[model samples]
Target: MDKSYDPFKYSSDSLEDVAEQISDVLKCPITIEDVNHRLLAYSTHSDSTDPARISTIIGRRVPEKVIHSLWKDGTIPALLKSQEPIHVKNIKEVGLGNRVAISIWKNNEVLGFIWAQEINKSLTSNELDLLKKAANAVQNKLLYLQKGKMKKEEREQEFFWKLLTGNTLRHDDMADGFYQLNKTMPPIYSVVLFRFTKPITEKMEKQLNYLLETTQLVHICLVTIDYNELILLVSPKEEQPLNQIKQFLRVMEKQMMQRYNIEHFAMSIGGIYSDISSVHIAYKEALAVLKVKERYLSDAEHLMSFSELGIYQYLDVLAEKRKHNRSPNYPLSQLEKYDNEHHSNLIETLETFIDSDSNVKTAAKQLNVHVNTLNYRLKRIQEITGLDLKNVNEKFSILLEIKIRNMGL
Candidate 1:
């Protein structure tokens, strides 16, 4: 059983404190309104230090003009009702100057709104990011405070676990959790895992975000690992028909390769799974499919599932690999040296043979190389590396070595 949260508790006070901080950073005035559109609290840059200005609006109803302006326009109110954050660019129509307003919500429940006025100038990317972070923090603080008031941690956890087990929806509780977590996540979602022909970069981070936003799938949660891979949690509503998640990933791959000038970015997508806990499983499957994608895809787009490959049993290993900083063992220098120096076609040969399960005939046919030439190169590989193909352990090591090499490690 959960205890009810007290409105007069310190948690609510802490939320107000956070809201004040957000108002300061965004350089805008804030008016936190209740569901009835009554002003619960208000803070302004000019009088934030003055407790009187903050208290003046406590019992007052929000101005009719502000309500009309926010709701009459439809977008912000709709976003508030939907519990999704809304960013309005040209908010000057309401006498607030050009601005971006982020609605604060909990479980699709409209708690209040935060208006970040772009009065002085256009917000730089960094500033915008900072504003977003601050706003989200305020929202998170409020959510925890609200939950504290309801004494609902046990109920929330039970509901969340049930959501995962499919025993119940408890959508109200689940939505509350999602709303709180969203503040700490990316604005768009995709189920993408990164592989390093090279380590991750800020450019990759920004690019991933851009892809989600441009795709118009807002409410994304991105988990980044140290090795430059990312896992995206995307909203289904933004997903397009005929544009499967795989295709969307492919488009991202193409853009990263061609437009961003990143030639070797590898992305694998597990087919979409709607349940929240299944996200981890989906990401693992995507990583597994990605390991094979490089050799087989040959292009920007490739989608495969571990189950489809009958490698579902190895899903745990794949999941471990998806963790950041676990680079493929073969160094990029060695792979490049082999690819660039040996007309031996050693790099392609290794990738293809491993992908084809060390089948000489199949590897040769796929590479369009004579069987004799393939065998000769395999001999050279043994001579150079002191490894025998007939040895199962050595074969596994060699296959992994080849993967490391091709990953440009």
Candidate 2:
């Protein structure tokens, strides 16, 4: 805002001031590099541990090779060319932790760029929002200084998003882009999109990335959403057995609960769908399953495969009462005769008494008889079946037989 102010000095110094404030607030390493690709200023926390000091990096062009490789890959080019800040993943070459890059300029002159590396921690919602606001503010400051250099960058960034989301090109161009994307992946892979009810924190995101890295278990593409959900694209080389995956999921669930201190985030695992494009539908199915939890809460995490839910059958009927009837192959008239001759309300009463676990009072109340009368009926039941109603095994078998015989009749 000062007229005699060096725009570079102002932005870099201002960035350092803001970074320090942010570092104090968030306790993260915040570093700002100038337009010349030199480190102008960094947070005190970063300076303490970083061997490369800002003085050494100031006024030097960042290595051509570093930006060149990224440009060739079209990642950095998209951001730098567009004049817009971008959030990038898998930028391991830049350094450990997640990186956010923003180009800086003022009065149509390129001021430089700022890079913030989230060290040892994932970006929190409030932190990310603050960073985004900070980045845009810095960009606007540059635009105020170097007016009229912003239009191209905006268009380029929009193009990048459309391309990334597969909304930019014709069907053929889309296929080609997908082909290039898949060239880095295994030939036969499966994509599973797991959705959660809560937003994944930076720590959980890093933990998930670490798990995938260590196990070499699944090639995962994680996209965090505003709705506090993760769109995970898991491409496993060669189909993994369901059991092994289930075990891993169980372990992950336990770790998430213990480490993050959150629970009841239902994961709806989609069926293994081959090819990348099918991944979108897989996400839909996973979402459907999560939505249907009311119907399947009894199973909990055990019900991963939605196709196995048999939802229709369940919705149409309650549990079938065990039919204690003879097989259809047996004579119908025989069953009728058995029922006619077995007019022994005594046996029926005994069966009911035993099924009630020999609780004479309960059986008596159920049968509208006295406890002594129910006990006498039970004694006669032991005489007929040669099984003690008092024993659990005997009681279970007798109850089962009674159910079967009832069904037969």
TM-score against truth, every candidate: 0.33, 0.35
What tens-digit string does per-residue lDDT give for candidate 2 at 116-182? 5556666666655555455545665444433443454344334334433546436455345445444
Off by over 4 Å in 2: 1-175, 179-215, 239-241, 299-301, 312-409
Q: RMSD of candidate 2 to the true fold?
A: 15.8
| Error at 233, model 1, angstroms | 1.0
lDDT of each: 0.53, 0.51
- lDDT of each residue in 310-334, candidate 1, tens digit only: 5323433544564554653443335
Candidate 1: worst 10 consecutive residues by lDDT?
1-10
